[model samples]
Structures are given as structure tokens and as C-alpha cells.
Target: MSRDEHRHIPTLKRELAEGKITRRDFLRYSSLLGLSAAAAYKFAGDITGVKFIPTARADMPKGGTLRVSMRCPTIADPHIFQWVYDSNITRQVVEYLTLTGHDNVTRPGLLEGWEASDDLMTWTLRVRPELKWHSGRDFVAEDVAWNLNRVLDPNTGSSVLGLMKGYMMNDAGDGLWDANAIEVVDGKTVQLNIKVPQIAVPEHLFHYPLPMIDPDENGVFGVGSNGNGAFELVEYVQNGKATLVARDDYYGDGPYLDRIEFVDLGDDPSATLSALSSGQVQGSYEGTIAQIDIYRGMPGVSVHEATTAKTGVARGQVDQAPFDDPRVRRAMRVAIDPPRCLELAHANSGAPGEHHHVCPVHPDYAVLPAIQRDPEAAMALLAEAGHPDGIDVEIACKGDPPWELAAVQTMVEQWKEANIRVNINLLPSADFWDVWDKVPFGFTSWTHRPLGFMVLGLAYRSGVPWNESHYANPEFDAVLTQAEGTLDLEARRELIRQLEVIMQEDGPITQPLWRSVYSAWSDKVVNFAHHPTSYIFGNTLGLNA
Candidate 1:
């Protein structure tokens, strides 16, 4: 019955009883803990076990530099920070907001808690009282309302505006969600009038592009401007290095480390990989399985892999020329063996991917079967599509001994057996997404996000900002919309399952492998991940040697 502050806050009275404190002291403790006298007695037992981590704890000694290595170059803007943190990692060091826990449940990080209307649209947010902003002003609901208003503002070019287009009192696209638009009744209570269920709201607070910019500073965004998180942005040298200092007044207790540094290596992934083994850098993110295995032998490094979402969207283009034909797409799907790809492609660094639009780790995901390799079926389809010998096409690939290249090589080797000619054009990734998202045919990397049905709406759904493949599925879109409105957990899962089936039936991007992503770091670094999208860097890593 260990108590988290989250539980203790709710059952203050019961916890007091368990602690054996006097009723008069219970009344006093109630006020000290910000609970009513009645609630203090009611939840006294729970309070007894509440773990209070005050910043001044003698055991919480903190002052050390954390070093982080990034696989990509420092970029200006990622545009789509809502689910995929498209912004530079240095910016992540400076921001804070409500977010999903590691287990993917709604968590109260920046905000104490929030409430949704019965309709699910239009939420009432309760900001954390007494929290301090980096600028030293007491944080209040105004920041939340202002940030949401910016996302709703059309001029901000916020990708969130598209996902939640209609829920705002004023349609942002047509210019209703404005800077001064949100109702800030006082300071602590702000009402967000969204037309959609407030599921993705937490995601909107993380990564780049979706940051909580200060309304006081116009065009004031990026690393230097934010300071509400556990870390503070200290330095950023584009495509080279970025650094951070701990935020003394962060809502989270502490970073445990004093500083975090990021080094960017563009076009030199091998050199970056070498640094981890040599101990020149504490950790390197988004390394291939081969490199990760190599680092495993190094004295003080740990490797972690996270399940990723593999959508046909933007990975490889399936809407043009040979790929445009659904039969061609089906043949491509049948051409490679998922088991072999999973085995050879990533070398068991990550989980064997299940068939779903999202990752298996995603909350409310449904279980499904993997597709078998049917080269005969693929050959038959290729012949039916006017080529007894397979059609020749080039693929663009990047990562893990170049898994994209390996998948292409496998497809080329397999398609040749079916009389198909395949050529893989290895594209150098100096920020691959910049060009990959626009490419007609290529395989790129991506991480799974927990926004549920929005996965389809963003990549597979029509008219999306990052729809790498031009796919049009009315039924899929309709089902996704239904899922968005369905609050029942299992019902949403079933809706997503239907959408997954739809993707399987109509894949615009041929999946050669469900990849296992890996990241390795020095023992000094803690709490880092190898994301599917390869975006964690700068602030997420805490230096604690």
C-alpha cells in the first residue's frame, strides 16, 4: 500500500487515520496538504504513505552534466510536434505540460488535473497552483489558455489546428481560436472549447512546434524562450551541440542532474556510434542493432528498444506509377517475409511487430495476426498486373545497417525469383523527413504515438499534412471519426482494429519489416529511449554519474 502523492491527494482523510494523528492535527495537516478537514479524515490512511519529495531533500544531491547524442541534425522546425516531436531536442529541455505516462495513461505533470465535459469536447483545466515559470512569474491557467489559443490560431500553422479543427468555439482555420480568445475567467481556471474529445491534448504540450510559447514574447519560440520543464536550455549550436541547465523551479521535483548536453552528428553516424564505445559520449540515440550490440559489451552502457508504428504513409510512396495499382501494392506486401525481415532486418533488437495501424504498446490496441510470405501469390499478382517478371523500382532507405536498404535488397532478391527487377537508391539522411515526406517512393523510419485513431487521420487519412502516400479510404476515415467520438475503451480498440484491417487491405506503403528500434547510453545517463521516430534527445536524458 505504498502511496503516491496522486493517491494521497485524493484520500487525505483516510491517510491521516492510518498515520494515527490526532483529529486536531488532522485538521492542521488537511490545510497544510491543501485538502479540506473532511477530506483529511476521510483519506488519512492514504496520506501516511504519501511520498513527499521536497526539492531540498538531503539525499537528493544533484549537480552533474548529462551528455546526449542525437542521430539527426539540429533543425529549425519539425512542424508536426503534436504526436511526433518534430522540433529540435533542445526545445524539449525548456517546456512542460500534461503528458502520457510511460504506460500511456493520462498523467498530471504540468497541470494538477483536468476535467472534460460530458460531450468530451470543451475541457476545463486546473493548472498547478504555486508553480513558477522560468521567467519567475507564478504559472497560472493563462499560459494553458494562451498556448491552446495559439494552436487554435490559424496563423500559428499549428498542426494541432488540423486535428482539432472544429471543437473550438471559433473555427481556427476560419480564424476563431485566437491569442485573446480563450476564456480566462480568472487565473487558475481556463475553459478550452474544443469540438473533439480531449484525448490528444497532452501530446500537444510536448516536442517542438507545439510548445507553450509566452504570449508576452511574439515570435518568441524555440529553446531559449521556454523554461517550464525540469531542464533549462543553455546552448544550441546548429547541427553540432546543444546544452541545458536544471530548472530550479520546475513543477517536477528535479532532474537529479545539473545539466544535459546534446551533440549532433550529421552524415557521421559511424563516428557517433564510435563515441559511445570510447566513452567520449555517454549515450547515443537511434543506433542500429549492430551498434547497439557492440555497445552492450562496453563496460557501463545500457540498451533499450521501443515498439514503433510502421504506417505505409511517408515510409514509401505507394500512390504513383507501378505502386499506384492496388495489385502492385499487394504484391509488394506479399514479396517479403515478415518473420525473416524481423529476424534479419533489426536482429531481434525490438519486438516482432503486430499488424496494427499503431504499435502493440499503444493503449487500447487489438491483437492481430502477421502476414505470411506468399511469393507465388505475389508473382501471380505481378503477372496479372502485366508483368510476369516483376516491375523494376527504386527504394530509399535509412537506419540499422540500413534496414530500409536491407528490405529493398530482400525485395530485389525475392522479386527476381518472381521475375521482378528492383533497384534501391540509398538516400543520405541529413534530415531524411524533409525529403522523405515528399518522395514518391522510399522507406523511412517512424515511431508509434499514443493518439489512438489520430494515427490514421494523420498518415492514412486523406488530406493530412504528412500523408506521405496519397491514400483515399472513405470507410477508414469514417471509422476513425467514429472512434474519436467513442469514449468506451474497448469500443475504441475495436474501431482501431477495424481501421488496422482496412490498412492491411489497402497499404500504400509496402512494409518489408516491422522494425525494432534501439538506443544505448552510458550508465551515467538514465531514462532515455530508442523511439520509433528517433526523436528523444537533449532534455529527456538525465546525467547522473
Candidate 2:
């Protein structure tokens, strides 16, 4: 193919993968460029595969309950929830400013489009006009501003706010909103003034934590009480179950199903799998990697599997003793072997690496030597750090899905080789969330973010509430800030490489494996696919006519 023929194809493929255009649009545009329909679709599939096809059924049946087995956390506040299950339930009722498709591309959601200044300091978002809240109130620019303000509010106690700490101006470290930080530029446009230049504004805006909320919305002691999303709140039983009815006058397209009921399975993956197998629930997004083979061959189930950057991390709080010494942290890193832990935990389903949620799928990915388990080296470092007698520490975890617990148990055995005594403190999944941050050592399950800098900003920034390790370095923070501000692809990758080196050398979190996640549904369900982050909602899901 000539340069002219291939140049536009690259841009068109990106548009299709990012969901800026549909597969039909890709086919139409590619055909104009002298390519067959099959060729055009093949190119598009190469970019994001078929997991994200816009499934619009013409003769779809209307009004039926879509039972889901997503286990929600104790806190259901859209912004405060730490796990995917909580976000899954809240996102059904509360829509985001930007929607991230299954292809990991972000498109307009509540906002029609957005523009940023050359300096990247000021951003202007054009809201979709005439949108309304589920309570029948007109949605305005103020609603958007209020939702963001809540995230910045310390009193709101939103865990995801850690991602926006430096991005948003909060000099007091308290979540108080700066009056000049946000401006309502007329009715349809909202302007945001950042403390520093940031090119990843859309990535943060695409977060599930930034869900639009009505000013009078009551998330506490209630569930799905108020939202501007495609579903209306009908009933809620906290930590148990909830039901949502589709809104007819929803601003956007279809939430084809009449209703969706979220059944709380807690941390029992077996119960969730059994429910899907028995025809009690039509679908579930919580299928585990260990059961992929079983679900794949099941009679009435269709399993959607994809390799994700999502990882199970063991956080060693640096502010606390033994871990306070950088040598001790390094010793911990070298003491445990990731591949062995992965095999023991996930049945060899995960790839062991130094990846902190940034997988090989990212465009900026660079191969770094995987950390090998060096028990002798770890012992020397432990002795050098003034712990010649070996250090005793507690590892807290919410044992679930079987693999994570197995991984943690294997880690304990590995640490013993380095003369490190580890006490396992296993808590229920719900109880784990309560002390996830406060605990000196714990396990956290992280999902895939759109960009590498996103996870870094959320989890590693100094003094941020979610900084699991409490590991602070001036140079690390500066590199992350610079990376997020730069729009150039190559420049950003260099900065990200610097970040990877920082984490590898002295960071306090141990990310062992990245696994393949599978979501399954009954054959009766239609128009559904698993997202890389498993972030899909019920808007386009339906049943056979």
C-alpha cells in the first residue's frame, strides 16, 4: 500500500479502538480509501479485537430483569468505593463525565467535548445540553462542578481522591475546594484551573470515582438514591442487594434492559460461579482466572477472557518500622519470587513481572528485567538494616477468589527463606476495606487504568491518602508531574521509564503478577462483552426476543 493509503488507516484504527468512531464508521471510511469491508474490519479488530463491538440489536426485546452477581463493598458511594464491584454497582446509577469503552478508549459522556490550553493548566469541558437527573431535575454545569468538589472534599472521605491531589489545588491537604479553581463559563461550559500543567486530565476524568451526582444525593444509609445515569433507583439493601430500573428519558442511548438487580455474593467466587451455572443470574463480571477452563466448556455460558494489567499488590507501609528502612523494603522485594507465587496462587494464570498495573499492552511499555528471588541477598540487606535476628511483620488480606490467598501464603513461605517471620492476618473482604489504608501491611487488588501515570498518581504520590506505602520521594513525585503534563508520546515514555526504575529500586509495594480476567454470562443474554477493566454497565445489554 502507498503512504497515502496507509496513513489514514492508522488514524482510523486508533479512532475505532478508542471508540471515537464505531466499527460501521471504520468500514465506511476504509472503503472510501479503496479497502474492502472485510479488510477494514480486520484492521480494526487488530487494534482492539472484537470484545468492544457496539452491539445494537434492532429487534431486541424490551423489559426484563438482568440479574448480576457483582459483590459490592460496604460503602457504595460512587467516589468512596475502592473495589471494582462497588464501582460496578454505583456506575449503573451514576454516570461519569467521560465514558471509557471496552477498548480502553475514552469518549464523550456527560460532556460533549473538551479543550485544554496550550500550557495544559486550564481545561474547558462542554456539557451535553438539556440533560436531566433521575429525580427529574435539569442537569447543569453546577452539577459537574459539585461532583468534582466532593472528591476534593476531605469530609466526603473518597479514597479515589488521591489520584487528583496534585492535579487539584488543595494547599491545606484538607479537601477544601478553591473558589477560583473552577469557573462556570456560561451554562454549557465549565472551566477547571489546575495547580500544575496536566495532559492526563481526560484519563482522570474517565475514572469511575468521578461520577456525576445531584447536590442533594444521599449515598450514606441508602443505595442508588440519586444519579444522572441510565438507571433509576427502585430499591436498595445495603451490603446485601439492590435493584435499578431503566430510565426511558435517559439523555443518551439505550439501557435496553428493564431492570438490573445486583446480588451481593461477598467474596465468594464459587457462589458467583454457581449462580451463573444454575441459571439464577443471567451474567456476572466477577469470574476468576482459575475457573476459565470450566466456564469455557459450560453448556449455557459464554466466557469473555482478556489479559489485563490488573494485579494483586502487597503494600508495605514505609512509615512503619522495619519497612521504614529502604534496605528492608529492598530485602522484601528480593525475598519473594513472583513466578512461584503466581503459580501457587493462580495456577500459573498470571505473568510475573515488575509491572505496577502498567502491562505490555501499553504503547509506552519498555521491558525491564524481572526481579528475581534472592534469599541470600535479602538476608544480607535485612542484616544491614539492623535486623540481624530477622524481622517479624504482619500481612493483612481479604482472602477471596482463592488465588490471592494462595499467593499470600506462598509469599510467607518465601520470606521464611530470608529469615523473615511473617504473620498472616486474614480478614473478610468487607472488613479488609475498612482497614485497607490504616493497616501497616495489606493486600490491595488494583484494576487497569487508561495510562501508566494514572495508577502512579493515585497510589504513589506523597501524602495522598491512598499512598499505601507512605513512601515519599521528591524526585519521584517531580518525574510523575512532568510526565502527566507532557503530551508528547516519546517524552512521556522516558518519564514513565524513570518511574519504573524508581519503583524497582526502592518502592514499598510488591506487585507480583498480572492475570487474565474472564467474565461470563448465560447464552440467553446478548450484546455483552468484557472490558479490560471490567467497567461495562447495563446500558447496551439486553435479552433475545
| TM-score versus the correct structure, for each prediction | 0.78, 0.88
lDDT of each residue in 1-545, candidate 2, tens digit only = 11134335567677778877666556543433334344665676776575334455676677789998877555446677677776777677778887656655555678776766656777787787887777777778888887788777777766556677776757556853467787888887799888887766765776766778667854442454777788876777766787888887877767788989988776778888888889888888668767878888989899987767778888888889978888888888898888887787777775885734466656555567788889999999999999988899999997776777887888889999999899999998768877888899987888887667778878888877678778798898888888877655567778888888888788887777777778889888877888888876788888763
User: Could you tell me which residue pairs clash in candidate 2?
Assistant: none
The count of backbone overlaps in candidate 2 is: 0
Model 2 worst lDDT window (10 residues): 1-10
Superposed on all Cα atoms, the candidates' RMSDs to the truth, in angstroms, are 7.8, 5.7
Tens digits of per-residue lDDT for model 1, 1-545? 01222222334345445554334334332322233323443444344554323223345435777666763354343333533423446445545455433433334556665555446565555677877777888778787666766665566655565455434434214665444346786788776665555445445444245555566665454557645667666666766787767766655645577776677666556877778777778876666655666767878888776666543222346567887777777777666665566666667544553334566655557777777778889899988988776787766655434555655666567666655566666666653545776767776555555555655555665544556676776787667767766644567789888987777767675555555567787777655655555555343445665
lDDT of each: 0.58, 0.75
